[model samples]
Target: MKNIIKRNPNTMPKPVGEYSHVTVIPRNSELYTFSGQIGNDLEGNIPVSHKEQVENTFKNIERALLSENLRAEHIVKVNIWSVEEINWDHFDNVWHSFFETNPSMTIAYISALGLPEIGIEIEILAAKPSE
Candidate 1:
């Protein structure tokens, strides 16, 4: 059985999805944490737009999740980083296309990504109940 977990927030807009903005799992569940994923495609070329980068990053996370027979819905926390502050509108469009709901998020603006063409990176933490 799966559960929805919501974390603390005060006087802010409610999340636009069925999921809580954050989630907590019991200690018994199996946990998985992924390294930060950048915008580079499998060929090692980065995409030109923020939307493209975000899409690629999400795909990468999905691939990782599949390896464990989990899905994006299992994600408990997400940290997003961008070379410049993300434009929320652009991000929202990209986000909605891929994720049916938003997971818990922490977003940051950074001076640079390790690669010049990279615009975004996403790190994820997820859990699934042990069989």
Candidate 2:
């Protein structure tokens, strides 16, 4: 985490969400790009409510990081796509529970996903300096 730098330049307006405008990854770092994760349980059951799906999506992100022996701090960027209108209040709670520090992020509202049952999906880019 110390190897990465997150910046919000004075030239630009402050970010609307809890995220940095720019992230700098150090040279010689190992980067990992994960596929977009959806809100499904191990059994592939997606919740009906958008709030529940949002929560589950973060849980899945955690699992993805753990799979590579990485944690939230290793995350450099997050990209989110949602079919439903996001409830920021509920979404923030779930987001804060996972990431203690801000990361570069992008979120977009779209008409639909690959499946109707999926309300949201998140993909992340993570990096760590090679030991």
Candidate 3:
């Protein structure tokens, strides 16, 4: 965790969201890239409420990281896209539930997503030393 530095540089504008201005990854680290994960269940049913959707998405991300033997703390960056507006508090809660350290994040409200029923989708990058 010490190898990954979260920077809020004095020269750059202060972050308006719950994230660092930049994330610095050290050399020789093995990076894991995850595709955007939605809130759909195995049955193809999506959560109805925004909060539920966000929660499910978080679970999906956690499962993906687990497959690679990585936890949220190893994540260096994250990008969240939503079809509608989201409550910052809820987002913060989800982040806290997953990550011990806050990784660099970018959240965007968009007109549409990959799925019509999905309210939120998340993608992340994680790193570990190459063995």
Candidate 4:
């Protein structure tokens, strides 16, 4: 198994979930950075609801991670963008369901997305520890 280390300082707000605010892996490990994913379904249609969009965006990230033999737990940093601000409680429910254990996250509220219905966008940085 790969060893991991948390790097958040005690002065910072405690993580609201099961993740540390930051993590460090061995220097030799392979790393992957994924682009921001929107809610577009496989058929090229964006979902209409925030929940649907968030779920699809996460699923897309999962697929990308799987292609590299990684999972959500391997993710180290996540940057999220939402139209207007997030509905925190609603977002928390969906987020915990997908991530199970949270990862380091940063969220921003943007004025708009190219598609008006797109309420959220997410990008991720992940690393797999070396054997």
Candidate 5:
């Protein structure tokens, strides 16, 4: 079952893109926050295309969560920052393909990043029921 309730109230303007206006996480859940994940692959090579960068970044996030025994389903929130202009089509394509549940996401087009090779960075907030 989903531990968060994501919604866009009718009274408020619909989100400009694929995201909810509000996200509500249940009480007593264990929250895990990850640092910004970049698109660097195992060989430390980052692809030049924003699409590839976005794809690899999500893959890295999966690998990171798995290291802690968590899967994509455990993620409650998604946040992304891009050095280039936001490409909704390509971004949503990769994002929807990766995550079955549309967790609330915050994405922005930023002017710069930590590394010149890194075109995109993503951070995620995951949760699990407290034992």
Candidate 6:
């Protein structure tokens, strides 16, 4: 995280949520781009409720990060897409539990995701300095 730079410029309006507007990764860092993660568990079970799905999605994301030897601090950007309205309160609660340094993020409400049962999907870009 010390290698990453987060900025919110005075020229732009304040962000409405717990995220920065820009993120800069360290030079020669190893970057990871993940596929959008849904609420499916390791057993491939997708939850029915949006809240449950949201929680599961983050769990999956954590697993994904760990697979690459990365942690929340290594994240530089996040993108969220939802078919249903996001519960910001619950979302922020879950988000805060994972991220300490605010990361650049974007969210969009869409008609649908990869599957009808999927209410939300999240993807991330992460960077860590190369040894």
TM-score of each: 0.81, 0.95, 0.89, 0.85, 0.87, 0.95
Better of 2 and 4 by TM-score: 2
Residue-wise C-alpha lDDT for candidate 6, range 1-131, written one tens digit per residue: 34788889999999998999989887889999999999998899998999999999999999999999999989999999999898889999999999988899999999989889999999999999766
Model 3, 14-124: lDDT tens digits are 888767877888778888999998987767789889888888888888889999998887788999999888887987888777777678988888999876787899999
Candidate 2 global Cα RMSD: 1.2
lDDT of 4: 0.80
For model 2, residues 15-99, the per-residue Cα lDDT tens digits are 9998999999888898999999999988999989999888888999999999999999889999999998999999999988898
TM-score, predicted candidate 3 vs. hidden true structure: 0.89
In model 5, which residue pairs have backbone atoms overlapping below 3 Å?
A: none
Encode model 5's per-residue lDDT on 1-131: one tens digit a residue.
44667788899997887677776777887889999999988898999988888888989999999999988877878888888885778878987888776677888888889988789999999887665
Among the numbered candidates, top lDDT falls to 6
Q: After superposition, how far is residue 80 of candidate 4 from its true place, in Å?
A: 0.4
Tens digit per residue, CA lDDT, model 4, 55-124 = 7888888888989999887888888899966667777777787775567777778899777787888999
Clashing pairs in 2: none
- Whole-model lDDT, model 2: 0.92
Q: Is candidate 2 or candidate 5 better by lDDT?
A: 2
Order of candidate numbers by lDDT, starting with the best: 6, 2, 3, 5, 4, 1
| lDDT (0 to 1) per candidate | 0.77, 0.92, 0.84, 0.80, 0.83, 0.92
For candidate 1, the lDDT comes to 0.77
Quote the positional error of residue 118 for candidate 1 in Å: 1.5
